[model samples]
Target chain A: MITITGLQKRFGKLAVLRGIDLNIAPGKVTAIVGPNGSGKTTLIKTLLGLVRPDSGTISLAGVSLNGDPSYREMIGYMPQAGKFPENLTVSEVLRLVKDVRRHSGPLDEALFEQFQLAESLNKPIRTLSGGTRQKLSATIAFLFRPEILILDEPTAGLDPVASAQLKDKICRERDGGRTVILTSHIMSEIEALSDILVFLQDGKVFYNGTLAAMIHSSGETRLERAIARLMEGGDAA
Target chain B: MNTTTVRIIKFEFSDVLRSKWVLIYGLFFFLLTETLFRFGGTSARVMLSLSNVVLIIVPLICIVYGTIYLYNAREFMELMLAQPLRRRSLFGGLYSGLVIPLNLSFLVGVGLPFLLHGVERTAHLQAFSMLLLAGVFLTLIFIALAFLISTAYEDKMKGLGIAILSWLLFSVAYDGVMLSLIYRFSDYPLEKAVIALTLLNPVDLARTLLLMQLDIAALMGYTGAVFELFFGSIMGAAISLAALSLWVICPMWLGLRQFRRKDF
Candidate 1:
């Protein structure tokens, strides 16, 4: 489980995360849904300790990560647009990641096979298409079976089939009692995979609950309309 | 210090070894050293001049090889940073990984041929010390400077420009400026001025130390006193080492701070 309290982050005078507080439950897929500039990425980076919040406390599994990096061991992250050195082959990249993760258990081969990365494992990362690179990033994120997986736009460049495969994998991972956090603008993806929908608007959580509760309370069958009504209304009632 | 940090260094070093560019540059450097030896004079003094050639190539190897290594490892760096590894350990590991192999290769590449030619044991020992010191100091200074530049600029070209400017300042421009100062102050007590100026550039200090070790300070005329002042006394060597150690520590400390605060 991940807990955030009084998280206030700012770049100059423009506040990105404004005293936000939330709890990310373990073994659940929590989707932070918001448009661009909604502070989703900043929130994720802060949680990962990649960015420092002006005032806040972030803890994973009851251990605070502020100014301490031990929490990174249980966390796996895949950025929105994964950038990799062009010269490294896929296998080499994996090996490099593996080298960094010394105390982790055996490699998660199931994730690799599910993504079908074996055939293209020897190819240079630069030669892989956008979809393949996303697949690679996804594979790397889940390879160590980390307790918490934070994925940013995991399906952005993936084909429909690949995206579906990844969604299924994410659901399976969550079902197996692992924490997963994802952000995507694709409504169908949110509708399909999110156990809890976190509606972020203007740097605050407007809503947080299951899709069933959101749709039932908002009096709409469509997830988009429920989100629109929630946005029309106010913060997480 | 941590095992994870050591593992990171081990893999980073392995990755650096696998680079074709690093291998190519190392080979080219070896060839250039050999060429300087083969086409030049055949006297013992010229044979000793190979030390000079070694001094020049060692620093160049340190700078170019290290700068390229950091730039090449950006992705891997990000990946590692996301892991449980400490920032200090990651940077420290990279610094060590770069220095060890290049220094070893440098020793074997130049020191081997010199020994094969049956150079005296004392001469070989001094030359070995100078070569190792030059390679180590140059590697640390440039690696620290390169880390600073890499974090200062987002673009690789800008980072490279910062690195080249730093190299130029340390390599040639600094000595030129010191000479100009020495000329203007020829009438004043210039000995201490020269001593102060020598502390500004480690590369020049290393060169003067190595050259003077071979008893070739006659090449620099009256200015050789600056070399003798630093590399001459026990006190001078201590002061020079302290100053050079600062050159390694300060920039790396600042770079790590900047990297931690960076938005990446």
Candidate 2:
């Protein structure tokens, strides 16, 4: 479980996360959705310890994440854009990450075979297309079978077939009792995967609940329209 | 110092080696050294000429390459940031990755030429070693300065500009400014003041060390007399080298502070 309380962060004069308090339970998928500049990425990055908060406490499995980075070992993060060393081959990149993680468990090559990256192991990262790069990112994020998987726009550049394969993988991970946190602009992806929806606007959480509760409260049957209605000041009573 | 840092260093070294720039830099030094030895008559004369080139060019290349590499590696750094690695190890790995290769290039480029030309046969081998040591110090000092600038500013153009300007100040413009300072205060008993000022710039400190090592203080005019009085002894040379090492450490320390607090 990941617990955060009183999380606040500001970049210069612009506040990115404003006193966010959230509890992310294990074995469930929580999708963070927000409009541009609404702090979705900032919230995720703060949770990943990439962005230090102004004042707050984040604890993973009851351990405080204050200047202690060992907690990151249990978490897997897939960045929005997978930026790797251009000179490294795909296999070399994987080796480097694995070397850093030093996990002794059985390697998970399910996604590797699903994405067919084995064929392109020798190709340099700079030559890969955007979709292929996304595949590689997803592969690394799942390689260690981390307890908490945080994926940012994981399906943004993937094809439909690859996208379906990833959704299945997410569901499988959830079934195996791992917490999954993701942020995506695609409403369908959110509807298909999220067990709970957290809507953020202007650095504040406007709605946090199950999809059914959010839809029922906002008086909109469709998930996309319900979020739009919430953004338009429709009170979630 | 641990296995992770060693792994990062190996990864980064191979990455840099593939870029071909370090190889070209090595070749540049090799060609320049060979040409200088071919035309400068004696090894002593060539060593003196090479000191001028090393003091100026090494810092310029080190700063520019260091800044650009840091900027270019920002993404790769972000990738590393998310991993289960300590920030200090990452920074240390990247720093060693860059400095080690450049130093190797310098060694192979300049060191090989000197060896092939029979530096042992020359009476000025001590001067040559001092020159090489100064070149290595300058490389480290300027690269650390570049890391400082790159980490402090988010704007790449601004960082690049400041890094180059800093090199220019140390290598070329600083001497001009100091000369005018001496000229402006010629009668003010400025010998100690000048030594203090020279210590502030690594390039000048290096030049003074090389010149004093070559025993050419008589040609350095007024400031030379002060430098000879101070840096002419073995203890003074050790002190100046320690000061140069501080120049390398201080900026790197500042850069690491910035890097630690920075949001990727």
Report DockQ per prediction, comma-separated.
0.63, 0.78
Candidate 1 C-alpha lDDT tens digits along B1-264: 887778877876776677655566456546654665566534245445655665566555566666766777787777677777777777778777876666556556555555444455576566456655766676777777777777777788777777777777777787788888878888898877777777777776666665566565666544455657545744555566688788888878897887778666
Error of 1 at B243 (Å): 2.8
Q: Locate the minimum summed-lDDT window of 10 residues in model 1 chain B.
A: B40-49
All models: lDDT?
Answer: 0.76, 0.88
CAPRI class assigned to model 2:
medium
lDDT of 2 by residue, B54-155 (tens): 888899999999999999999888888888888888989999999999999987898888888878554478888888899889888988998899998999
What TM-score would chain B of candidate 2 score versus the native chain B? 0.96
On DockQ, the candidate that comes out on top is: 2
Give candidate 2 misplaced runs (Cα > 4 Å). A234-237, B120-123
- Which interface RMSD values do the candidates have, in the order shown? 1.9, 1.0
Pairs that clash in candidate 1 = A206-A236
